[model samples]
Target: MSESSQSRPVKVTVTGAAGNIAYSLLWRIASGDVFGKDVPVELALLEIPAATRAAEGVAMELGDSAFPLLCGITVTDSADTAFDGANAAFLVGAKPRGKGMERADLLAENGRIFGPQGKAIGEHAASDIKVVVVGNPANTNALIAAHHAQDVPAERFTALMRLDHNRALSQLAQKLDCQVGDLSRVAVWGNHSATQFPDLTFAEVAGSPVDVDQSWYTDEFIPRVAKRGAEIIDVRGSSSAASAASAAVDHMRDWVQGSDGWATAAVVSDGSYGVDEGLIAGFPTIARDGRYEIVQGLELSDFQRQRIEASVAELRAEREAVGDLLG
Candidate 1:
């Protein structure tokens, strides 16, 4: 906890340090892009035992970068070691869905990975640790992690829905010929999968409410944003890594620094927007003072409601599939 002129150097743990997404993420974090330029960080990078050598290689690269805000680095294969005293964690490790694999199989595999990590986090992480799951099946993985981490407040666990949020922003920007930054209040609701609803029902472009054709919103915009991952894979022959990493940074940055306005994140629902209680569902959120609250009083149109319900239903099925892991 060494203090710089700005703030104490906080310990941040990142799982799956050797993976593509984490490879993109670590340099950004070490350079203080996720935190602030003045706020230093001690990175605890975790990989599986087989990837320990690769993790060390990453540490070597970080050393070469010589980032001013990077106070220290620890590379390990053990969750307990990685999470010990961690002020923040990115649960980026999970079994990816392979070719011909069913959704149920993917959920079960990730459950095995996240369950123990969650328990370790509950026992070893800092009292105020904030966690975000960047792994596949993220929303339900987050739900599993939060369920196991009883010692940590459930509100601290979130899944990355910022990717979907950003995708919606970009698609809208492309359609309207506006800068992505010019749009605000773009909400991504429900799961991170194809079922996610990128609700522009309340969005504004350049300080004016956007009124667009309903057909375009439904037929083109929503599907494009929802399936952006597949589109990336089709173009690149790989899953999204850099964009996912960037979105994770955005999610955590706004979370730690306070989003000036609305952002979308998958947080454990307090029954907001009729989402089932205890489910980690994406919703319009505000991050302030190092905590997130689901934005209240946004009236959902019937279309939005039905879309969110479909996504939540998928989440519910995922939960039931991993029911044994919840304990």
Candidate 2:
């Protein structure tokens, strides 16, 4: 067998290459530790034409890292060319709401971006390409992207929820004054929106309910995790970009490297949770063999069900808003 064929190098494409997530994501992917020591990675960066120069600067820094397992780097404005031969893709770019912009406008703008990018990936990305969307309005944007990428597996597109999941776990731990390692199976449900339900009933500390008799829930817990995103925005005067970026790295890392914990993510539905079959919705999941299977049959309390349904409503609304644009 040929030595190069034996190695099976992975090519990772980062769309929105000049964005904050890509800045953090590229360095980690190049370090070879992203997929562990044995797997080598080639980075392909896709940036819009207006952002290409800044992306080049990011690529220059990647060159300086000198990571041993980084096989190559390719940067381009063409999504088709950038995604070509890619085994994994991080869809992290989208139009940010300028001052006074509406949600419909944001969805419309992102539809324009993800639709073509999705088509490009479908046309040129390797057959095994696994895509994760990190941009805002992620769930529907992933749906839009997935719809256009007909050749790619529908299961291949997913949106980021690891951040919300991690945030929920950390807040619960801190409120209970317990270590984060003690928490397991925490679920972040519905859209990656203000209404997302962070269900802790099934989460365990020593295989027991995380509430420990409801002390944490009634106290400073739920609000802390729910408001964490706004907290960052309040303190920073800008929405989270670093912690968000860090979450992107963690999502791709665990997806490629393998992990034991159930990582929650917004994946396109196949009628899970009664969410519309094509709308991407967040659920508790475990990633195995580079795929995520939502943990099923969780017992949902009335309160939790209401919260998740609210978020699902938001996602469904986004789908409707972007419906005409999808074509």
Q: lDDT of each structure? A: 0.92, 0.83
- lDDT per residue for candidate 2 within 215-325, as digits (tens), equals 657355566666787898898887787777778777777776667988788887888776788789998888787788888887777877777788889998998999896
Q: Residue by residue across 71-160, what tens digits does model 1's lDDT show?
A: 899999998999999999999999999889999999998888998899999999999799999998999999888988867999999999
- How far residue 147's Cα lies from its native spot in candidate 2, in Å, is 0.6
Q: Native-vs-model 1 lDDT?
A: 0.92
Top lDDT hit: 1
Candidate 2 C-alpha error for residue 158, in Å: 0.2
Regions more than 4 Å wrong, model 2: 1-6, 212-220
The reply for model 1, stretches above 4 Å from the true place, is 1-7
Which candidate achieves the best TM-score against the true structure? 1
